[model samples]
Target: MTGKLTAQPGKREELADILLQAAEGMKDNADCELYLVNVSEDDPDAIWVMELWRSAEAHTNSLKDPAAIALIQQARPLIAAIEPVKLRPVGGKGF
Candidate 1:
């Protein structure tokens, strides 16, 4: 999935810290093939995340994880919204 996240106009640094820490735990999950985070060039506060899991089950399971939940809670306020759009790669390198 991929989407944008904008911090409050002046809270970019703090928001980045929270998001980075929140993602620390998710990096080790075996089911996650890719979990990339990016800051929008046009919108400094906007963060774009791209995640690829081994299966839908893995993604679902992550939702129930405590670490994931905590991270969500921590970043909720800093995030304006999570506009994730699902995708399926048809060809070429998917990494």
Candidate 2:
């Protein structure tokens, strides 16, 4: 999954930090193949996240994880807008 998140004004860096923390935590989940957080060069408020899961179920299950839920709660208030895009991997270098 790929998502574009816009932070609430000056909260972009704060949101990115939380996401990076989430990325570190994701390392423990075997089903979580990848979790990458990126920033847009031109847009200070833009945060892009790329995630790859072993299965759709794994992705769904991650939302229920306590740590993930906590991170979500932290990020929620900082988010001004979010555009989520789902993608199926045909072939990828990371996977």
Candidate 3:
């Protein structure tokens, strides 16, 4: 899934850091194929995250994981809004 989120003013970096931590935590999760984060060049408060999961069920179950929950809790307050982007993966070089 692809998502764009706006951080609370002045908290973009903190949000990115938390996402990076989440990426680290996902390293051992076989269900998670990708957990990529990028900051928007135009919007200072905007950060984008791209995720590739083995399945929808896998992604849902991940939300209940303690480590994932902790990261979400840390990031919740810093997030102003989250907008999901509709995209499908066919094939890619890095992917």
Once superposed on the true structure, which residue ranges of model 1 sit more than 4 Å away at CA? none
TM-score of each: 0.83, 0.96, 0.94
TM-score of 3: 0.94
Q: Could you tell which candidate, 1 or 2, scores higher by TM-score?
A: 2
Q: Which window of ten consecutive residues has the lowest lDDT sum in model 3?
A: 86-95
RMSD values for the candidates in order, in angstroms, are: 1.8, 0.8, 1.0
Order of candidate numbers by TM-score, starting with the best: 2, 3, 1
Which candidate leads the pack in lDDT? 2
As a TM-score, model 1 comes out at 0.83
Candidate ranking under lDDT, highest first, comes to: 2, 3, 1
Give the Å shift of residue 20 in candidate 3: 0.5
Model 1 agreement with the true structure over 2-42: per-residue lDDT tens digits: 66677777766677777676567777888888777777788
Q: Of the candidates numbered 2 and 3, which has the greater TM-score value?
A: 2
Winning model by TM-score: 2
Q: In model 2, which regions exceed 4 Å deviation? A: none
